[model samples]
Structure formats: C-alpha cells, structure tokens
Target: MIFLAIATCSGSAFAYRPFDGTDAAVAEPGELEVELQPAGVQQEQGTRTLIAPWTVLNFGLSEEWEAVFEGRGETPLVPSGPTELMMGGAFLKHVVVPGSLQGKDGPSVATEFGVLLPDSTGDSGVGASWAGIVSQRWDWGTIHFNAETALTRDHHADVFVGTIIEGPSKWKVRPVAEFFYEKEFGLEETVSGLVGLIWQVSDKLSFDVAFRHALTNRHPVNEVRAGLTFAVPLRFEGAHNR
Candidate 1:
C-alpha cells in the first residue's frame, strides 16, 4: 500500500502572475507548460502516498482566441484498498476580454467550462464543471483569483479561491494561498497555503519548489510538495520567453 500526503497548488504557466479572478478561465495563446508534483508520508498502519501528475497545453487560435487542453491523473498507493486512478475530461477556456492586463499582456477576465470524465475508482463520476477566473497585475506583483464549482450527476459542488504572490526577483518566485469549500464528499472544507520558487532556466525549461501546509484538520492529510515545470514553445520561433 502507498501512503501519500495531500497537497494543493495552482497549475498555470505564469507562476509569477498573481490571482486576478478572471485569469483562471482564459488560456494563453501558443503556450504549453507541464508540471509534476509527487509527495508521500508514512502511516501507522503501514505506508500510503499519493502520486499526481498534470499537464496543460494551450493553442492560439487568433490574436484573442485560444484553445486549451488539460489532463491530470492521481494514483494513491494504499496498503488495503485498490489502486485508485482518475483520468479524462478536457476543457476549453476562452478569454472574454483581451489585452486587459498590464504586466502579463493577456486577458483580464476568462471563462472556463469542461466536463470531467469518469475514472476507474468511481470516486468521482462523469460530470460537468465550470468556473470563472479573473487575473490582474499589480505594481508589487501579479494576482490571479478564481472560483470553481462542479455540477455533476452525483450532486457535487465545490468552491475555491486562490492567490499567487510574485516577488521582485530574477527567478520570479511566488507564494500561493487558497481556501476551499465543498458541499459534497461529506461537507469537507480546507484552507491551505504554499510558498514556491520558480526559476526560468531557459526559454523552455524551468524548475519549481514549493512547500504546502493545510490549516484545517477536517481532511485526514497534510503534505509538502516539490516539483519541476517545463514549458515548450510550439510553432513559435524566438528566444525562450515567460
């Protein structure tokens, strides 16, 4: 069995960008970023850990139009239960207002709508999820704020708000904080925060390190996460840019 700690973090290409609420629904044009986070802990019964990997790819349809595809998988290595795996559901994000941000040079308000495909474990059945994200840039840093909810056949819904604080540094390090509320899954709720450092090694390669801690004990897990992020430019020719 595998014992893994639970950690929550945002999956956006611009790690330095702050929470603007509208940015979560919009996809950047002609951008592809990959993020991988792995964490685990030892349990008294035995040992259990969680392995989660996710990737996001965005394509520019026009100057203001962009298409996005994202996929994520979670595998829990537990001693007694079956190996749980969840997969599928590709969503599309559209930028409602283009060139509304000062620093990121992207849309300020974006809308994201997608469907979650069923998985082998049956933990989350097939359903549709939708959310709105707003992103804005500040003199000190960039901010991204997002609210997401799930509309499924199983009558499940959740709301989440997060902020990313970008520091004044060459590597573009940012600290993140988030609060989550869920009506489904036995009225589970949590508040978590993470401190992360991002280094743009090159135009296409970057590394990220983060420590995550949960503020509420409502959930039976707490964890720290460390991972690397790589961005690959597609159909664009130039020096590696963030």
Candidate 2:
C-alpha cells in the first residue's frame, strides 16, 4: 500500500480515474462526486500499491463559475511500513468555453487554480503547493495540462508537469491514457506512461482500470489500479400531494 498525497483532482474525470489527472469542467452547483481507486504495480524486483479515496464537491457560484473542494486519504506501502497521508484543498474553475453533445468542432476550455496542503515531511515531500491547471476538450477526446510548483519548508523546490489524455467518449467503454513527467529543482527527471479504460455503467456510475509503466528507470516501477466513480445531484423535494 503506497500512496502519493499529491494534487487535489478537480471534479471532471470518471472515465479517467487511472491517470492522476482532471478535466476542464466542474460539477453543477450543489453536485457531489466521489471516487475510490485501489491500484498497484509489479516490477522486476518488487511491487508498489496504494488505496486512496477522494471526494469532489462543487457548488455553482454563478452560471459559468464553480467553487471546488477536494479531499483525499492515502495509505501507501513503503519499505519501512504503511504510511498514511492526507491531502485536500479548495479550487476555482471557470468554463471559458462550453462543449455541447452535438458540437464537434470547437474545444471546451477551462482553467483551475488551487493550493495544496499535505501532511508529510519537508525534506522529500511538500509543505505546500501552488498549482495551475488548463484543460481542452474536443469531439474526439480531452487533454489536461498541469503545472505545479511546491514550497518546501527546508528551502527546497520541486515542479511537475503532467499531460493527461483520453480518447473518444461516445461509447460504453472509452480508452484513456496519460504521460506524466516530474522534476525536482535539483534532482533528476522522472517520466511515466499509462494506458487504461473507462467503463460507463450509466450516467451516474462508472469504473476505470489502468496499468502504468515507467518510461524512465528511476521512478514509478510499474502499477495496476482500478477505481469507481459516482455522482449524485442535489435536488429539492417537491410537494406532490394534491
């Protein structure tokens, strides 16, 4: 059980649970979504695993704006023992361009800005994080680009750039893939790739499974993960009695 209490994912991915990525949209006002992913990996010499659950809470601040809240708990299997980490944050998202079901030409554009709070050591981990997210969506697929820079208590800095991609979504099952790269201020670079699928059971429930392989020999090893995502819309009861 290994966990990385990294970014607080925005509320837009259900078919993209395997990759640590987000979409360019936010939940409707008063809508809540939760995702649980339990995945691991196998390598030449050892294995790595993680069980983490994150919740996305969104409230429509306006017609085109949403306030987002995300929180997650992770328990990772490490060489010493199982370590627990908690991460959460609040974010704001604006849908600059909206995509429609029939619209296939233009891309939906959105931006997210947030701060990350993590419970970990200052030496190898982050004390705080400042992140900016940009996403684009077309008829064929979607792309999420992330740039994150963290502040460490010990005067160290780390930065990450992640690119997340998913294929066409007009089917019961859709293909999802990702390529992620990270570089610490003074450390070597690490790169990873993943391929997976998103199974849509219905509009409200879905499942995702993915396998990650290391492009660089230094980090990530190999991993297999699966998760479920569901959304529940908040509604007010109406009086039906005559």
Candidate 3:
C-alpha cells in the first residue's frame, strides 16, 4: 500500500489542468481564470472518495502577480459519508523572472505564498505555505518544476517536489505527465504519477482528463479526473483604453 500526501492545496494548484504542479505563469492583468472539475473519483484500499466539484479562481493583479483561491467538496462513497467542503486556500503568485512561460527566451521563475484556511468542519486551525516554480518551453514541448513547503493544519511540516512534462503547444490536444514525491513530517511519505491530455478549444478555453496512481504509506490509491479551464477579461469603463 502506498499513501502519498503533499500539502493538500499545494497539489491542487492546477497550473495546467489534470496535472498536480504549476507553471511559472501568471494570468494577464485584469483577467480572471477559472478552473473547474465537475466530478472526480479516487479509490484507495477499497474506500472511495468522490469530489463532485473542485474549483480554483485566479485573478491577475498585474503582469507580474496573480491572486488565487481554491476549494472543494468531497464525499466518501464506500464508507458512505456526507458531502462536505474541505481544503480551502488563498494565495498570491509572483513572477520573479519572466521567460519561456511568458514567450520569452529562458525559464520563467515564480513563487506562491499564502494562508491555508480551515475547512467547513472547522476541525483544524489555519496554516501557511510557500512554493517556488520554474518553467521552460521549447518547440518540442514544455516542462515545469515545483518545490513547496507548508505548515500543516496539524502544525507539522510538509514538503513537496514535483515536475510536469507536456507535449508540444502547437497541438490542439497535448499529452501531459506529472511525477511527484512528498513527505509530511511525523506523518507519511508519498509517491505518485499521473498522465493526461489537454484539449485547447481556443486561446481562452481548455479541457482535460487524467488518471493517477499513488503509493501512500503502503496504501494503493487510484484516481480519475477531468476538468476545464477558461479565462475571461474583466471589463471596466475605459478599461480597454488603458
């Protein structure tokens, strides 16, 4: 049995749909980006977890910064549990050095820091986290690296390191893969892998699907996920004139 755990919201950043890590890119200023997972399922040790919906909202504050909010509702199917809201976070992402991720010449560098809020159950206290990101792009494909550390709700420390590989951006449908390892001090260590595809419907919309397998402290877990990402420009009086 393998049980892998990273900072909960950390793995849920969703830089590019269906993947766990994030890219070093911020939303365009005054633009809003939304990520939605209408339904997702996870199975572990004969127990099933269902996420009817998971959501993340990113608002571009400037060319170099973005604000992020994420939350989800989950239910245990096999054990028969009521649906409950869990894992909420608020973060700020900043671009330290713009590069390939921004259509420039080198790898882009960024960082995200924020507070992890308690769930609806109010069983845990507030926590905080920070993450670093680096991403590069090429005619062939794109790759991203992430490293994060968090002060967990239990007041323990957690660390996560991961990488994401993506197929050529020119393709309407691109292949994506993610590999990660994480450890929560005084708790457990985890290893996981995921493979998926993203369909670029247009410059502002995308759809994705992925499958993941993990070994979390010797417990085997499997998951299936699908989602969509879209961006909308914020309109204001004379906004376009700026």
Candidate 4:
C-alpha cells in the first residue's frame, strides 16, 4: 500500500539529470530551467497513473543561488474522478562550491530549504524540507548524493538518502542509475532503485524516461516516468556561466 508520493527533477544540461537525484549545483544567475513530465505511472494492486502533469520551474537569482517552484496536479486513472491539485513547493538552493561540470574533480556541495504549500486554504496542510547535496565529476561519468529530511503538515518526519551515477555524455543518449532509501517516522521503511536515460537533444533541451522498482515490500511494485527538461538563458554574468 505504499505510494510514489514525491518525485523530483534537476539540472543535467547544466550538469545533472531530470529524473536523477539533485546535483550540488544551482542554475546560474539569470538562467531559467523548466521540466515537464508528460506521463508517469505507478503500480500497486492495480495501475495508478498521474495524468494531470508535473512541472518544476527554476530561476537563477545569483551566481550560486537559485529560486525554485514545483507543482504536481494529480488525476488518478479513474474514469469518474476529478483531478485534485496536490501540494506545491517553493525552494531556494545555494551552491557552496561550483563544481566542474566535466572532469575528475573532487566534488561540488550545496544546501536547499523549502516549504510545501497545500493546494487550498481549506486546512489541507503544509510541509517543510531541507537537503544537502554532494556531487563529483569523474572520467567515466558523474556521481551525486543527497540527504534530505521533511516535516509534513501532519507533523510526521521523513528522511531520504539517494545517489545517482550518470553515464558518459559522448553520445546523444546517456544511461543513468540510482538507488534510494526512505524512512518514515511511525511507518515502514522502503528501498527503491531507478534506471533511466538522458537524451541530450541540444544545449537547451533534454528528454528522460525512467523505471523505478521497490526493493522492499513497503512500496508500489514499480513506476514508469517520462519527462522533458529545457534550460533558457535569461542573462549571463559571463560566457562560461551556464
């Protein structure tokens, strides 16, 4: 009876993947990044699909800082149910060190803080979350790790630990994989893993599709997700600014 309650997207054109865990970098000052998921599915006793669409909008405010907005509208695959908007989130991310996008460098680090806003003021609820990230560029590919904690409106706390290893980018399509574990206070723990691909269509556009399966019985059997991400330059401090 576990659910794929939360999902995320991040910068890969600038140095991360859409479906992978977040990287230790933020959008450059004056840059804009958007991710759109056209289709996503989760299966438990039966198939539960998300058709209302999911989106993430990121705006660069400074060289090492970015403002983010994420929202997902849910329409469970029932023929007669109306779509109910889920909680939306707003976050601020700061990069402590700008890591190399490519190379065998040490790593980049960042921190993020955010709040979840309920779709309505009808006492639905809210949540707060924070995360720390570490990422490194390797000869073979890139690696990223995230440690996150959240306090939902119900006052329950949850923790997530995730990591991603993306394949080399010499080709138009790159393979990526990740493993994640989550622990919910007063609830059963769950472990899951993902395998996906990043299709770099251009400097500003990328597409991704991924399959996630639960490693523990506390979650849905599997999930299928496909999305597209695009980066638009608002303004740049310099030529090297992405």
TM-score of each: 0.69, 0.72, 0.92, 0.83
Per-residue lDDT of candidate 2, residues 113-163 (tens digit): 555554443333324555555666666877777666654433357676778
What number of backbone clashes does candidate 4 have, counting pairs of residues 3 or more apart or in separate chains? 2
The candidate with the higher TM-score, 2 or 3, is: 3
* Model 3: lowest-lDDT 10 consecutive positions: 1-10
Each model's backbone clash number: 34, 10, 11, 2
Q: Candidate 4 lDDT, tens digit per residue, 98-208?
A: 676523256888888887666532464777888888888766787888888887545578788889889876668989888877776885577878899989999779999
By how many angstroms RMSD does model 3 differ from the true structure? 4.8
Worst 10 residues of 2 by lDDT: 6-15
Residue-wise C-alpha lDDT for candidate 3, range 80-143, written one tens digit per residue: 9987766667889999999998878999999998888776665788888899999999999999
- List, residue by residue over 19-68, the lDDT tens digit for candidate 1: 21235433345665444444323232334555454434455555555554
lDDT (Cα, 0-100) at 87 in candidate 2: 45
- Model 2 residue 32 lDDT? 60
> Which is better, 1 or 2, measured by TM-score?
2
lDDT of 2 at 139: 62
Task: Quickly count the clashes in candidate 1.
Answer: 34
Off by over 4 Å in 1: 1-31, 38-47, 78-83, 99-107, 169-186, 215-217, 236-242
RMSD of 1: 6.6
